[model samples]
Target: MGEAGFESRFVAASDGLKLHVRVYGQPRAGRLPLVCLAGLSRNAADFDVVARDISATRQVIAPDYRGRGLSDWDPDWQRYALPVELQDVLTVTAALGIERAVFLGTSRGGLLTMAMAAVRPTMLAGAILNDIGPVVEATGLVRIKDYLGKLPAPETMEAAVALLKTIGAGKFPGLAEADWRRQAEGMWTMRDGRLAAAFDPALAKTLEQVDLDAPLPTLWPQFDALAGVPVMVIRGEHSDILSAETVAAMAARRADLDVLDVPGQGHAPLLADARSIGRIAAFADRCDAA
Candidate 1:
């Protein structure tokens, strides 16, 4: 409800936790809505700009998973697994009466999207995987682990922007100061007169338990489930997560898959740019037509 007249909804998860979802626009009879799933440590706010644009044509729902943003944090951080989050997602969507829709997932969100394809294929009409694939590179994961939920509180919002720039500027060379500022605002919330991480710090424990040194399993079977659905992958030009080689392999599996290489971004392409937003909106239209 900040500017575009979107509604903020609190849905009850299976465990009775109130989950927050930012709903933009109204559900139409024929056209499918867009569900935006954010990266690890991110929230519904991350998709605000793109969601607003797409909402003009189709409904957009961006949800903050348990322990993130406005959602209630889980007392047992062990419940922060993908299966648990996926259940929460289904609960939110069912409460909203969404039968099938397009899913736009970034990083860890993309992983969840693949999981959905395996468990509830009918829920996905189309999917946009932003800078992630079945095969996650260990190096990128290590880099993410170094920062996730462990950031120091910035005294000022501007300092938060500066801090992000110092950490991510090298990977996202195309992002300007303004873009960083916007990201900082989305990523942190003011608490006790200090900017705090939008997500619960306990969530980090989920990653800390992972053994990066061990080889990660690929979700090729789950990804292959998307064969019947329209798929588009948005990879950052300099991304370390969704590598070009993986995209090539994906294309080999699904010859019809569409790929967009976002310039000057890394790990995940922020769908905040005009071109990226337009591509996604057009993809939604194409899905509706199909």
Candidate 2:
């Protein structure tokens, strides 16, 4: 509810696919920017709480990847992977005329940040990784796949609330029933009186090929790209996505690295909450200071 406006635009990627984006901030003639990137299945609006709280001094840009939110669905759903999304982020930066910007990345967005750091290190000011690490837990990935595209469409708001209660019960704890209901409406869209997932259903296809036994690819090269840049990583104490041991390992290598662990959360900590929000803002302020 700040003075931020949601203006939608499109930036054409090298592959000629148009990626949708939303901007939140006042027009600044000369000022460095701050960008927010959402989780795998989330859209730009996922940053609404964070952006609205910081728009006074930072130009916040949020993008909906090829297969999510208002963006066009890829003809080849396999292109929904991280490699393609990284290219799309570069295209977005080029379109915005931003030389460098601080990244407030959540989940998949955090992985994309590491990829960018490896592929194009010069474009980033710094990065705050929210509940994601180079290594991921197979258990969480498997749990996510179980409901990838199997959730039933809710016919009414009440039905949507009920669906969220049943599905999100274990996922997001410590939230009231009303909070879960609000989150459900935000994640879906109303289509012909039924509440449907806002993202393209084809995105679920990526989960079908996930191999849990194999070790996930190492992203050290990507993390190396952030060598001289300020980096902060936030993890949920109960998160399966980023284990505390891995985070400690990352910190050992980089003495300047900052780490935070949110209690009573798992997989990913909701950044919109006040406790995490303040930490993220402080990280950005440190980036500016440097």
Candidate 3:
């Protein structure tokens, strides 16, 4: 077993939603917890590879946001918006008596981290923005919107594995057959021998409101709040979401902020690989020390 024993629990969010939180690591280490936030549509298990690789000195809590993963689907699809997600994050921490934590946020999770900076700056000890930045490109976002809630049912787990291989070919290449199966297992929920989206299909409505054609909003001010704290930004080399110019500007503004660009990936880089895991472990140790 890892230093922090793996366990699952249902934590009550402010809105009475019992969000599922999967924990890894030692909570009594006297260090601020390290919270893993998944992408918009993904869940706690998205951090399975991440949680195992991080240091055992601090706690790691990964939660399935409102309408996704093991969490109960919201009857009102509008409740699946960012505000509710952000509130749920705060509520989860409060329930666990965690006053502060290092935020490792991916994609939509990164937005929540920034939003927290805007609303509750003191709650974060540090933050690592995984393949995301304040200035998100519309083209990439549009592509995400296209895939949300579109997963079709697969007749068998083998068929699901095949479908996962075909769909993730461009984003995830050089993956072994076993790794592909693992990805599929973590992504879909099987019921009655059929595969379904792990999340509620209605949550798709919340995504339709995203206006991709408009100019990206300025988010440096929200990000600047973490200037004094340790900040690391991971970017995929081929990503359309975060531009090179914006990253350069961020580095110029904050000397402590580190920027790492992963090659041969686009949109987002999966942190499951050994190289990516090592980087995260080092960053977490640095954050623990800070």
Candidate 4:
């Protein structure tokens, strides 16, 4: 639950598609703003709790990438690639008049953060990557592909919660029943009195094209571009996407990198928990002090 009365706004992407942003809290002078980027198929709502908590000290902004949440869906699904999404993020930063920010990126968002560091290093004050790294595990990619865009429409809220729990059982072990319900609310939208997934079904096409048998592209160079900027990497102990080996490599590359391992979570740890939120807040404080 982010602060009440957050401003809902939009900016146009290079393709003329409208992208949505949720701005929370007030901007404090001399403090770097926080920009949150969600995972693929996720929206600004995913950071509701985190925004509320951090905004008390500095401004927090979360944007729904094109084709997800309130943003305009691309008619050509191929535009959903990383380069295009990275440009869209740049457009958002420009539209908001943000000169610099501490990026809090999760999953695909974390990949975008690395891309930004490579292309627009000066714009980033720091970054915290949640459950993602230069190397992605094939097992995790397979799991995501299994149900990416193929989720069935739920007849009721109860059904939606059940579906999420069924698919997310081992992934989010300690999450309460209420958290699952909240996740359902964020992931699906009620249209014409029926619940359908909030994101465009075409999003799955991007994953479908990936050949798991072949090696996936490595982003280590992009990560290396962030050498001077402060960085924090968080990993869920059971995360299939961000393996322990990748985390070690990331740490090896950046001697000053802050690392945290959240126990009992899988692909990603929800930042709503006190421990995660506190860690982020402390990391931001250090970035600001520097």
Candidate 5:
């Protein structure tokens, strides 16, 4: 165990892939365990800040999808689809003896939460979606597609930080240099004496079918499946993915929804900030009470 008080667990998926699941803290007597899911191309490191804090009162589990982080890369890139990823999440949680959990998903993680609600409703105690919804904006997808697997590998940590700030400073204007630096550290890793993006480059294959000119499929039914549970959405003020229109639609469907808009951020709000995390911690308390 490291200073974060989290243990690294390697769980085997049904397909025989090895997955990394970070387990943090001891379970509180009454608090529901929190399962964190990261975005596309992101890894377990993304949850380092929030889990370190949230795990103080309740257990937190953050899993890296097969192709990201320390997990084994899938031989068939097509297995990177959500169905496979969802199975991996279930497998990891089950291995950890977690029958149910309050899911906190960021970006692609949020999508998996909805899928979980549809296929395994009993496992969902509550949900927190960070800047993602049934209706994903194509513009945001385009932006992500343009950069995935194409980022330049910088020679040093400082160079990596500068690259991130140069590319991301516009959307996440609220983030400080220190914030960008941390992001740099998490987004890349050293391998073969060279710095590279943390995720397998083959992940780009999954986006090859995305049609920029066409509307992507929506998951309103999946979102609706969570109507019985407490739900919270944390959106960036400048987010291009979870639009205001979609949020209004979500609210229309479920009026009890808790929405937090983080100013000066875009697409997804980093739950790393004290204010954002405090709200999430409070939401967890309510989930426990419910």
Candidate 6:
């Protein structure tokens, strides 16, 4: 457990791999837990700011999915599939004694949120889909694949930040140097005095199975299952992955869905900013009251 108020704990997956989860704040009776799920190749650190900000109101749980952060890596990379990841989530929730939670899922994590809704709708009090939807644009996916695991480890933190800037230049326009440094730190770790990506390289292999030439699979059914639950969706204004058209369709289907399109961002917005965090907190409070 971390001494910084938050508790760092591990739960064993069915296959015996240990998955790490950081618990923030004390549990309040009748208040729904908030779980922040990171994007592909990202981990619990991605939620540091938002989790800390909202922990005062309700318990916050951030998990380092298998092969990311302190979690045990799967020898079989294929196990990185969504079904296995979903089970891992279930195991963590069960171990934590949480019957229901309001989930904040980013990118790939958002897809997992939809999957969970389909398989276990009762487990979700609400969900915030950050920069993701039923349909994924091939262009964004192709862009991600272009460098997913191809970048070499940086020799210094400065180099890591530079690399990130070069790669993420126009995507997150107006992000300050400090924000980029924070992002670099979150995505990579210093090991042997060099910076390396925080996730297993095999994680990128999962993307190889995607057929960019063909249409990507839609998760409308999984999304439809969330109709009973309060839901919020956040989109990066310039995101290539979650298009405006898809968000419109989602809103058309669920009139109650709350939507936020963050300006000057792309693919995914790092929910660390004040405005985004405040909006999410408000949505969560509403869910808790409902």
Q: How accurate locally is residue 205 in candidate 3, as Cα lDDT from 0 to 100?
A: 82
lDDT of 1 by residue, 1-290 (tens): 66656899999999899899999999987889999999988998889889988998889999999999999999999998899999999999999999999999998889889889888999999989999988898889899888888788998998999999999899899897778988999889998788899999999999999999899989899899888899999999888888899999999998889889888898778899999999999899999988
For model 2, residues 1-290, the per-residue Cα lDDT tens digits are 23436678898888888789988875454445778888888888777777777776778888999978878889999999999998888889889887788887888999998877888888888998888877777777887888877788878878878887786667567767656665676678876676789888999989889887787776677777788789999998778778888898889889999898887667667667787878777877787777
> Per-residue alpha-carbon lDDT of model 5 for 191-221, expressed as tens digits?
9999988888999988887777887899889
**Backbone clashes in model 2, listed as residue pairs:** 239-267
Model 4, position 175, has a per-residue lDDT of 91
* Number of clashes recorded per candidate: 0, 1, 1, 0, 1, 0
| Runs with alpha carbons beyond 4 Å of true place in candidate 2 | 1-4, 27-31
RMSD list, candidates in order: 1.0, 2.1, 2.1, 1.4, 0.9, 1.3
lDDT of each: 0.91, 0.81, 0.80, 0.91, 0.91, 0.91
The clash tally of candidate 3 reads 1
Error of 4 at 44 (Å): 0.9
**TM-score for each of the candidates:** 0.98, 0.92, 0.92, 0.97, 0.98, 0.97
lDDT by residue (1-290, candidate 6, tens digit) is: 35566789999999999999999998898789999898888999888889998998899999999999889999999999889998998999999999899999999899889988989888898999999999989999999998998998888889999999999978998798988998898889866676788888999999998889988888898899898899999999989999999999999999999999899888789888899999999999998988
| Residue 231 miss distance in model 4 (angstroms) | 0.6
Give the residue spans of candidate 6 off by over 4 A.
Answer: 1-5
Lowest lDDT sum, 10 consecutive residues, model 4, at: 1-10
How many clashes in candidate 2?
1
Worst 10-residue lDDT window, candidate 3: 1-10
Cα deviation of 154 in candidate 3 (Å)? 1.9
